[model samples]
Target: MYRPKTTLEQWRILQAVVDHGGYAHAAEKLNKSQSSLNHAVAKLQSQLGVQLLEVRGRKAYLTEAGEVMLRRSRHLTQNVQDLESLAANIQQHWEPEITLAVDLAFPRSLLYPSLQQFLPECRGSRLKIIDTVITGTEEAITQGWADLVISHHVPKGHLGEVIAQVNFLLVCHPEHPLSQTSGPIDPNELSQHLQLVIADTSQSPDEKQGWLKSEARWTVSQFHTAVDLLLQGIGFCWLPEHVVQPHLADGLLKQLDLDGSSFRRLVSYLVKPRPDNIGPGSQLLYDLILSNRQVIRQDDNTATTGNNP
Candidate 1:
């Protein structure tokens, strides 16, 4: 294996000398002798066969080569610092990465804000968000694929906290046959038309959710696809109010006037797949979701009522 001639310490010393303006100031800041700082930088330049710094008057400045190398070296030093921080975090029981499985029905309004809050406080930890539908969320929990899960269903053996309730509204394109129907739409009428459904993203897909009373159904893997199909006036399906809010507001989509309830409220839970071994990062995210649960509920109510609360 080929070895590097210079060390990270040497590069760091060079950066300090340039950042602090000269050897004397850098030594004072780093609590090292000026001669030692000069020696380290000199040794680095000698090993690389490059004159990295030019001394004039009482200050040191970078040469053309030194300017390019210093820019690259700053990145290298920052990476090393991050690596050390990651190692320290690992030692303190902070997870290096956390996998979060969220149900398709969950509100993006709530999920995104929680993630935004968690980003800065994660302490170098990485987040993996898995967008799951129906049985897919349950699979993520039971199969040990996720550290945190937000789903409509909490599997048999695991415990979950009710985090948010999403309103799934039955909707169709404004120009569709359903939109022209007068008064309360009959269930029999719904079964005659095609329904666009989101397919279960699991190994073993389960029965489709909502008014599957229709014999003619089109299934897709994602909500966006379903929304696209709905926009074409092709079919009708129950979609989360948040996902369809903009379309509804724009008159691109309209909620169907069903005889009974026009919307279904799905209560999503925050579950820990490995509760006993929950890391600080996962727990922090969990707490954030819980703290923001009320805000999610308020948003849901606002969406349903068409008035700000």
Candidate 2:
């Protein structure tokens, strides 16, 4: 089946090579002789039926197959380690735990599903989910308070790929005065009726200035709070489209059209170490988060343009 697995010796060897950059260096790292490393590599090659390295003038070069094995092996090793760490985190993850430095707000419903589908498979890594503001999130990244961070593609230093598009949606109460009115209204008028905004996220303040006029009924930092206030008929806010799909269709809320406002949320996945370049845990988390985003997108289309949402 071409199954890939890592061993204790393989683990040590991989670390040696990574640390020292070649078989001889690896031998030096493990305090073992170069002949011993050569023998071990030969054994590994035979077991995997592949050429792992090439000896060139007392140096070593990993073949393509060897590189693949190296990446996969490291990933598997990290996963095993993460499994152990998660066990100790279960109680804490359940106790308002699992620290995540996300944008001002994310989808609560989607997050539950993301956790439900992925966490159990992770051997129940206890989570301590905490939310820090945007600038604080960047600081958390620097300080190590956040084990993982999820934000947009900011101009400053970044860490991961742009997974999908996070669309901006202008939503309001179903019975609000806006829905009753005609075609797309001016940004100035729309801003006048109601306003709910996120103060700190990956977005530029100038980016949201137009969507949120000079006068805002409520200016909050979290999406949940904004949604709550919007549902209460306080004011409208420009939110990620997927987050407000259900509420809009349930007749609980409505999406407003800004004829002149340039509002859009380009979804991006910013994670340290990244997916392809990250450890197994981060990879799993990234995949799960993106998967949840796809599901959320599906739900959004079905509800927004369909007859019955």
Q: What TM-score goes with each of the models? A: 0.91, 0.50
The digit string of per-residue lDDT tens for model 1 on 93-146 reads 999999998898887777777788998999989888889999888899998789
The most accurate candidate by lDDT is 1
| Cα distance off (Å), candidate 2, residue 8 | 29
Query: What lDDT does each candidate get?
Result: 0.87, 0.62
Error at 298, model 1, angstroms:
11
Q: What TM-score would candidate 1 get against the native?
A: 0.91
Error of 2 at 248 (Å): 1.7
Query: Candidate 2, residues 1-309: lDDT per residue as tens digits?
Result: 766543558656855765587887788778988888777777777777888778777667788887887777777778877766666555444222345566544445545666777676655444566564545555555555555676554435556544344677888887778777788877666756757666654333334333445474666867878889888887777788777888978989888777865456555454662222344444566567655553124554421211121
Per-model C-alpha RMSD: 3.4, 16.8
Looking at model 2, residue 88 earns an lDDT score of 57
